[model samples]
Target: MSTISVREFSYNPSAVFARVEKGEAVQVTRHGNVIAILLPGSGPVARYADLVAQGKIRLKAATSADRARLPHYEVPADVSPLDLLLAEREEDDR
Candidate 1:
């Protein structure tokens, strides 16, 4: 498996897909944190356990029910997520 930053994935998605097409696994990271994995669907699904053991992919953290549940956030309609995040950072700095 190969690791790629989010920026690199964004810069060339086709290239990443090409790697998977060649039966290579790809791990996508953000800020040095693993966020997702791209696996070749044509590969045997049974080998997923082996991949997980090898740390090629993180185990599922959420169940189907968790995914089906909608998350509701109470925020002003005009507040941008970036602004909210920045405000939280400012508060942390204090």
Candidate 2:
């Protein structure tokens, strides 16, 4: 792990970028207050797979119709699927 002031990161971004490229985490501070972190993103699926491989999490498989038609559960016919889809799309863009 490494710590760098926001000023240092701003003045010489390559140095912080190099540390991130090496898979080292970094903490960035502004006015002595922790503001952000820098890390390499290798994609969510691969990272999730690695976590499952390391037993950090458990995996599950669900059958079709288990959702929207489970015995005690159901999706209302009038449910607004479009609204949910739009929200998810906005989150993905973020």
Candidate 3:
């Protein structure tokens, strides 16, 4: 494990990331207090675990009833949903 100040990490983030990529864990400190830890991710599962740990995302086990409760939309066979979304966004911007 390696410790570095936030300013040092910010000035050269790629170097810190390179260290992490080489299997080193880094602790970032602000004013002598540890603020964040950088770790090498294994894959998507590790990414999701990090998000969950950081309170950025919540995971729930959805039951069949929960799936049934979700609203379903019907689009015309010839219509593009992306077009509809863009049109709605355009209206919102005005």
Top TM-score prediction, candidate number? 1
lDDT per model, in order? Answer: 0.75, 0.63, 0.74
Positional deviation of residue 72's Cα in model 1 after best superposition, in angstroms: 53
The residue pairs found clashing in candidate 1 are none
Q: How accurate is candidate 3 locally (lDDT)?
A: 0.74
If ranked by lDDT, best first, what sequence of candidates would result?
1, 3, 2
* Runs with alpha carbons beyond 4 Å of true place in candidate 2: 43-94
Over 1-94, each residue of candidate 2 has an lDDT whose tens digit, in order, gives 3678988999999988886675555668998875766655553233555564455764343234544475342447787777766776899999
The clash numbers for all candidates, in the given order, read: 0, 0, 0
Provide TM-scores for the models: 0.49, 0.43, 0.46
* Model 3, span 1-94: residue lDDT tens: 5789999999999999997786555778999997887766764234665775585864454445866997575779999988887887899999
Which has the greatest lDDT? Answer: 1
User: Cα lDDT for residue 67, model 3?
Assistant: 61
lDDT for model 2 comes to 0.63
Model 3 RMSD vs true structure: 13.4
